[model samples]
Target: MTLTESVNLDNCDREPIHVPGHIQSHGALLAFDAALRLAACSDNAERMLGFALPALGADLDAPQFAAWPHVTQAIGDFAQRSHGTSGLAERSEVQVGGRVFDLILHFNGRLVVAEFEERQPADREIRPFTTLANGALGRLRLQRTIDDLLQVAVTEIRSLTGFDRVMAYRFRHDASGDIVAEDCRPDVEPFLHRRYPAGDIPAQARRLYVINTLRFIADVGAAPVPVHTAGAEPLDMSWATLRSVSPIHIEYLTNMGVAASMSVSIVIGGELWGMIACHHLTPMVVPYGKRMACDVLAQLLASNVQTLLAADHAKRIEAASSVRVQLMETFVGGDGLLAALRPHAAALCTTFAADALVASEGTETFVHGGVSAAAGAELLRWLRSSKPPEGLLAMSEQAKLPPVLSAALAPWCGILALQMDDNRHDWLVLLRPEQVETVAWGGRPEKVYKAGPHGMRLTPRGSFDVWRETVRGIAVPWSATELEIARGLQAELHRAGGARRAQVARDRDQMLAVLGHDLRNPLQTIAMASQLLARGADSATVGPRITRSSTHMARLVSDLLDLSRLQGGLGLAVEPKPADLARLVREAAQDVTLGHPGVEVAVEAPPQLQVPVDAARVRQLLDNLLGNARQHGEAGRPIVMRLEASATQVTLSVANHAPPIPPESRDRLFDAYKPASLNNSRNPGGMGLGLYIACEIARGHGGTLVYEYHEPFVVFVVTLPREARAAAAGEA
Candidate 1:
């Protein structure tokens, strides 16, 4: 509705008209009970009560409802009634199905006023002033995330007031109440989807609901007040006796079998909205002062709601709409998403605090942008080993993270991660490390941590201010609106991604195009040369040329396949079998020497040192290391291959006369595309995947291959288990 249209009452035919004078004098009243079922009462009683009330079918002479000493005395009083008919009434605090009423009496004559009120437990513990304030703020923090808001609010209320069942009650104009939300104490009956009738809470009683919005009712058994007439000039209702409660209302509760109930109206902007109801099967009393405090809490909550909603709704919607599109676009940019987030690495880390990472499950690839550069390798290893949860995470914390992360991210202080999955497409993650105090540095969210041991002494507003400041400094503040926008944006991006799958396919074509141009031409030239040699040109010349060309082609194919398997998630084929470790070492050394006749190669493999392995893959592994040394090391220096075996394992070490690997390249030795030489002369005609693939192949065979830095020489070691060696020994 337009704002102008809303305010223009003249055009609003259905809108209720309000008179300012009536609002001030007796408060505005909206009629609730217009429809009445047929019922009969005596003329005098009808005149007295001002209405033809329903039949309850009972005498007025009962001792509880009247002043009869016993049932017999009440019968005697009934017998002495006048000739005209008297009023009929029923009172009960027990099981009588249908609408129950309480503390009822009938005088067989017309009454002056028929007021309505419910009996309540007189003693309720008033929450301390400090608790109310602290709790209110705690609720605010809980509301930072969407899913947590309702849960946190319910938990806080249940804990503060100790209600058996504390529920967030919602009301419709028809005078009915439904439990919209509830937080039941442990072991209590779950009330999640429970519904209740509106007649349970009468319209007259609802009008007075807000007075105790923050009240505490301790016990209902001890209520003290002088019974007084309704509408008496000085009628005092602060107590039970001074104000007459409706007999029908009491009967209604009794029939329902609820002994004691406490309700605090949740008023937003001084207007009645709904309520928080605490119901117990047993009677209880709440002290007056405590009740007042509860009212204050209700007022505070109402004010917050009012503040949040009072702003121009359009302005808020517009602000949210503006950024949502871009946020979602950033979330689902596919391969480009990671690159797009690189600049916001710090922002992402601070937002999630931890549990932040950028990953491509499609490629089994992930980048830990939140971790330090020194810790990237470690973080990657962690990501490879750790599994992410399914679907988009609405909001989850690291506390529930699997135990494995602790060992993996041990280098960093604390760890946190949050992820959003794009349908089934990809994942967007935010990771954080403890020492990376984004909270204290950002000052975005105002947080209130639970008070320390000293209850009143350590509120967020008081003793914990210093710690609050620290956390506040590090946490990047994201408003609820911001999160909503981000969520909406992510959803949009997911939709866009579905629409752009064709574009993405085209992009993949572009990648293949680049790959063909950059890689296939050289391979094809070598293949042509090999084909010419095989055509029987010249044995001496073409024989070696054929071998060289074939080896080049083999290397190219091996690199391509290994890269494909790594990206494809197809486990490498590794056949571990009995083989002579000594013979394999000598053969690999001889192979490298044949390729480089200028370099001297020596093997020191013992005849008894046999290992179970795939001989050809092992030979390739050693040849790669030795060939790398010959192609990059000093020509005349001896390249030594050493072999040793333990009872359970065998080790092969190859050392060449080369300077120690540079410090910068040491960490990335096994990383694909990271050659030892940036100028591309380190291993002429070599692809950097040689070392990486060799490492993977060794791991596949349940062994490890690594390089160690030794001054004037770089040593590459391959370690294999004794089972492989024992099998080989037995075979030999």
Candidate 2:
């Protein structure tokens, strides 16, 4: 197989660590068949358990195991628990041969497996777990910053675990890590502040760290005993605390001249944030009690770290908010929007720690600091046309940029741009200068290969040499706080612009009201003159034609006046009185029939349904609904008007068979001057004012007008309260 394929097979993610056919020398494992007869055993079982290897098929009740009754009983209990489970259970400490040993039992298919590890006696001076945990926590609470907190953690862990070195390692954004804090012996070489490549800890290894919080390896130089089994596949030991370490990792530690090691994971926000790695120069075993104490300490540290980071972020946001307020005040006091921002451009850039700033609106461009005029224009063009996501674009590296943009934006490698307005080509751009630095790596990061039994295989780097590399074409990264502040500024600008537009709309509506009132006098005069001229015999036809045109003009003018009043603060005017709504609907329907011949009008109403309403306004509401139905309803189809009265309210429904309204048009259907369709030919002679006026009249009487587009029909409903005065008072 190719070396790449070999590397992949041995990759921690794909490695068959569960069935590795191996076990640590510190433990002895044995397997038995369904009949409780010995099936297979690890090579060291005879030395550790005092069991003969040649007697593999011997029954469990044989004379040889009579001295170890506790071992047999423990195995029996484990078998019963593993029956319906995943064939695994927790380790139990038992006494055998006048010594304490940890026993682990599991079932692989039909074969029962048992592992045993002898435990060493604890020192008399070792402190109780509660005492140690309390002292560690007390020390941890004294820290005020992340650096201080991490330093305390490494020191406390080293003292508790008795390791030669304890380092607080933190992962960067790209998965690489650096030794941020260390507590080690004076004779050992320091790994503090040194960087390690992401590949040094593979993805699967990192995931395992999150699952199994603490891992301990007593001796890296010891041989791994083969786990013999009758079945072709080996047992899965992923949760085994005594599980054998990977071969590559052993070599890695050996090269560092480390005899043993242990690591505890530091989790934050439910993710693998970093680790507290400890190395020992000699073989050393940490008892389960001590390991538990370390785990508790790590968890406490994670909680404190989260709180400190949040507080730091809040401080940054407060500073940014102050800067934003100053810029906004400048805009409000200036002669124009662009003029307001130009003078404060340098301060705006500095808020985000950028070296240059550029603001562009239409043909006018303002540039400050290091950016050239040509580069600013080119960047503006890209910002407008590219349409980056969230109206914000950011890049930290220039080497990875597209060639066309790189050529024009040299030296200024990084950019953070925010579009100021959605309707215009205006933007605010922040430029950062290129930053160059050299990074020190532990060793050559590239894969190295060597000839092996399988042809070729990858091997860990043999040397721990320091390799330095110079990086260019990248700038210092922008923090999360800066991006959040940019978004906040965009939102404030939008709010201010909306307020300005609303004022302009109010001015336009007032002007229309005045113009509509002025045209009324001329139209009234035309109507009166036409009627007087109709009395003459010679001008009879011409006079009548002029009268019809003037009457239509007068109705149009009245509609304009009502619409203007409705849209303004003063709503519809109404005087309510007891009236028969049925009579009003019939009269309106008759008028529609007269206007359009051959169009059927059907009215379904009770004999007498009285409600408190304005007679003229109700008639107007009915007339507008009928007119809308006649204009849009399909030809030769009947229009239905139904009226129903209840204890509290009365409902009037007008429905017709016509083409369904477009989904997009339904929302603004009642808006003045907003036609159902943009095509004028669809509903010719429609001023689009009918529905708007109908809605206003309904509101005046404490009623509502609504439309629904059911298949094969378009329906409009107007509902009015039975007690109009009570409804109007409640609304007020």
Candidate 3:
């Protein structure tokens, strides 16, 4: 669609309404460069403005325009005040041709385009318009709903402009407009419920609506005045108040029998939401001051409407959040997401304002609310087949669906589907019933194409008679808030699923690592000893080695059996007899040295310290702790032990020359099946259950075991009651 192309119904959208090269007859447009040299002026400017029209005019210092210094002074003031911003247009009045005229000035690049319309003394002044606008804004602020707000607007605009009819038109998603609110005189025919097609306002015109807040036509039948410019390129009148509109639009008004018209754009979030349209049966003009006041009201109305909509979404989001909490409660209470959704189906239906839901997980399908089992199956099938790459799809008009599928889910006009996984097998589908609405159009909402003398062209509809339409297979559209909530729900479910899978995998891998490491070395040593004996090596050399290896393996196997029993809720068994705790710790160290001969051990204790503890279990606990130190401590560094006794209890601690345990693994150090380092490259033969068994042994004697990471050292401390007979009995 280029400027050179002839406009038809197919290409009118590119008709370029901004640089029209003309302006309305009621006003003269003059554009001057930064130096105040006239750059462009309307052809009628010589008659309207006493100054001669020049193809390239002289500067402000020229003798021709020296008499009226106010015009030049006003432009200088406007430029100084509106320095860097090219925002809204500013209005003022100047004396021209011995008559007062309204002046509107705005910037288009470096040029200051000014429009002058002859003003009458009867025109409303600026002070009264300020009072009128503030009063209208006060009324607007009192209305809570959009319908009420627009109702007040049309009434106020009609009263101010004295138009026969004034209406607030709201655009639909398709750009067609509906007369939502209207105020008119008694004799005028009311178009209160009329609708207009998008073609009535072309795309380029809509773009200008966002920039120019208000435009007026004193008389639609008046001829347009052409603008003459010195430059080769056409002037851009995007911000010019007197900028002319498309001839097709003028034809549209004349066809509708309108003599005069005015429109104030209702812009929201920088897009044209609609307009406040005024129509008159006789030629009429709204003074500049009054029109500016109406523009302010239109802007305020748009802001209030946007505020109302945001408030509605906020309420809905709050309620949906509460329902989500209840759903989560059900999810954790038992049989997976499907079960959770089954009982809360009615809640979900209300949360999103939906009619029914169909949830599918693998082979299982759950139908809830108003959907029949058969309809649920069909909906599920469609969701899986049409799953988007991101796995969320929303359809507002089910008439767009295939005929077979649409018939299968009759009476439903919307479907919102969320897939549970990357594969399309699982889904949660929300269904909404069709809302059939009847709309009344001002005329048939379409273009009429006919062959003209020049070529084929599109014409405006000839009639303004009422045309009604029954719109069907469309539900209330899914809102942005509902879609955002659905996205959050899907993401949360995926995160929970990932966490569950990781935990299960982690547990299994840790167990396998421990079993492969702890049993491998002992089994290998026994195998080597048996081979050496069979190859005629002396029994004296092999027997003790084989016996020691067998003992270690047997103890490991027994400890594993005890853990298996623990899983069945049994406690470790222990017999308490008075014994020297110091001796037990010493013996445990000596045995660990036999396993790792190069490792050294040191003991610091009162040798005679005694307690009612099971000596064998205490020795086992010591052996496990010592083995952990030997495996992990720096080579050639000695493991240290210390013991202290009190009247009722005794404390024993083991210190090893090893790096401190990482802070993240500290809490789970005493838990079974968790290794010190997640990195598998650490020295092996540690089942990660040493601390668990030691803890259990301490519990058996009514005591506790704990670990701490001091810089450059790892320490395990144990505390036991001096008289453990009662504690042992309690454990049994």
Candidate 4:
């Protein structure tokens, strides 16, 4: 039932406002086809142009065209000059009904449309074009800063147009606008510094603003004179100055108590940068000429603003480059990431204009600067939950943090974060303290609705009063340069850390390779010892020596099997069965003694001691211990082997004269780069893996291999349960 209802909430953006079916009452529109025939005209065409378009089927008489005969030649000249179906061409003047009018020519689709605007008394000579242009351009050229430029623009435009209020509204990054500068009569309330929501100017409206640089509404309340078409398509009045405004915009202006309004777009680099908006309390006309002058000023302002903004950004980046260079100088990978950053944490906080820095490696956390430990932990916890693998976050508000941590990290209003791992761990975070400020809005920006024919429809707020809000929990936004530098550092740290881990793994693999090759020596000894046993040396005496040598060879293959698999070699696996433990021990001693010709091994054990075990692996364990003793024990000192059996277990002791190993250095003897190599098992290998291999073999048999530095003799004892675990052997 209402005009605005046609442009309601649902179809606000989709509405075809551009092809609105009418023109304002102040002007009349006439559209003619290429054949010089009138196709459409406004309802008031007879009153404004002294003639009207004939009906769809009728023909026009020569007398009918006589009233506006100048239009025929004007259309041809306008079309030739335009080069396209856009941009209105202003005619000097046209006469109708004994009065002068301003006629603008343009094309809409295939039709040439001409809008004729009536002139009031004394309308033409407000100020000549050259005089107005020289004065306005000269005054604008004097402005030095953006603020001064905006202020002077609004002041001069108001003086030129004689409007009640004028403002230089600049768009924010969000597309919202601020009344950055204003010039109005003393009676008018000030709207300077007031903010308007982005919704105030919808997307489609912004697009039109750029296309039609000058917009004018002479009166808000008057109904538009509908256009009548005769066998023609709906005419596009996009470039027509007298096109009717959207009904919703009409109501919006009405609500503001603005009788007339005008605006000129400030477009820069093909974007709608801002606008020069003028408002009048009473119906007023901004003649087409005056509106064009304001349009030119807006374009000049946009160009100026663009240049100043670029200069500002360049200066900021130049200043920030020094800080980035300094940080990189201290960030080489020779020292680990945490170690390198620890001493510079405080300086980094200041460099980023932040209050704290927290670097976490998932397991360890390093914190520095003003934040408390609890707050730093809370920040790490937030990032650990929210950040994805190799993800980045730059938040300038504390409220975005989890509710639980909001209180603990309240003092920190912003965070720049980088996470390296997928498990939500390992992040470098910088936190900035809160910066509080007050913002003044044109009105409350909340959406309000009114009951309409189609349920609820969004309506403009009635008041334009300043609504103040104290904004807190916000921080100065991180600049593009700062973010770029942060990402660079993050990438470097991640690269260095990954390389270090890879290097560690390579070193470990190399050690295993050397350990596996060390097995060849023990294997050779077992071969030589077997030949002596086969030479008919008396079965009762040499039989135990043969069994022990076989056991030592098994341990050597077991240790090398895994290394072989890793290095593209063979795998030695096992299937356990019953075996004689005492005989194996004696055999291992024979091989070790043969390997060290200067040392003699004295075997002491029962002739037969049985157990369920990997017999070869048990022999291998003995070989490692005996060989180590033979190689490192004092020369000419007999290496002694003592074997004993119980109902549930068997025990073997191999002892030789040597200096006692210190307790502090004994723990890693079986593992760390062969501490056994100190005196017990040193070999041509990278780190003598003899002790470590011997220990693992004992474990695989559910047995124990232990080192005992009994005074004056370094001893290794092996204990085997009656039944071997064989779990390690099973995996192999």
* Among all candidates shown, the one with the greatest TM-score: 3
Candidate 1: worst 10 consecutive residues by lDDT?
Answer: 24-33
Sequence-dependent TM-score of model 1: 0.42
Write candidate 2's Cα lDDT for 1-732 as tens digits.
122346533454565555567777877887776777777678888788765554777877788877777887777667766773543555677776676776767665566777777767763223575587779989999999888888999999888888999999888766778889999999987888877887777776776677667878888988888776656656555555566877667767877888988888888776788889999999987775577689889998988998888897798778778877877775543323455676677777877889998776544566778788778878888788888887888888997666778788888888888887765477888999888878777777665677533345666666767777887898987776788888888777666556544653654465445445445555666666666676664465566556655766676677777876754535567888999999998888888888678989999999888899999988988988887887788889999999999999999999999877776676556655452322346454345678878887886787789997777889999999998653234322
Candidate 4 has an lDDT of 0.72
Better of 1 and 3 by lDDT: 3
For candidate 2, the 10 contiguous residues with the lowest summed lDDT are 1-10
Predicted candidate 1 versus true structure: per-residue lDDT over 318-387, tens digit per residue: 6556444444445444234443454554554444434455544342334555443324334444444454
Per-residue C-alpha lDDT of model 3 across residues 231-305, encoded as one tens digit per residue: 877888887777776767766787788989999999988888889999997878778888888988998999999
Q: Give RMSD (Å) of candidate 4 vs. truth.
A: 14.2
* lDDT (CA) per prediction: 0.48, 0.75, 0.79, 0.72
Better-scoring candidate (lDDT), 2 or 3: 3
What's the CA error at residue 248 for candidate 4, in Å?
2.9
User: Could you tell me every candidate's TM-score relative to the true structure?
Assistant: 0.42, 0.58, 0.68, 0.63
lDDT of 1 at 319: 55
User: Candidate order by lDDT, highest to lowest?
Assistant: 3, 2, 4, 1
Model 2 clashing-pair count = 0
Query: lDDT (0-100) at residue 18 of candidate 2?
Result: 53
Q: Compute the lDDT of residue 505 as modeled in candidate 2.
A: 61
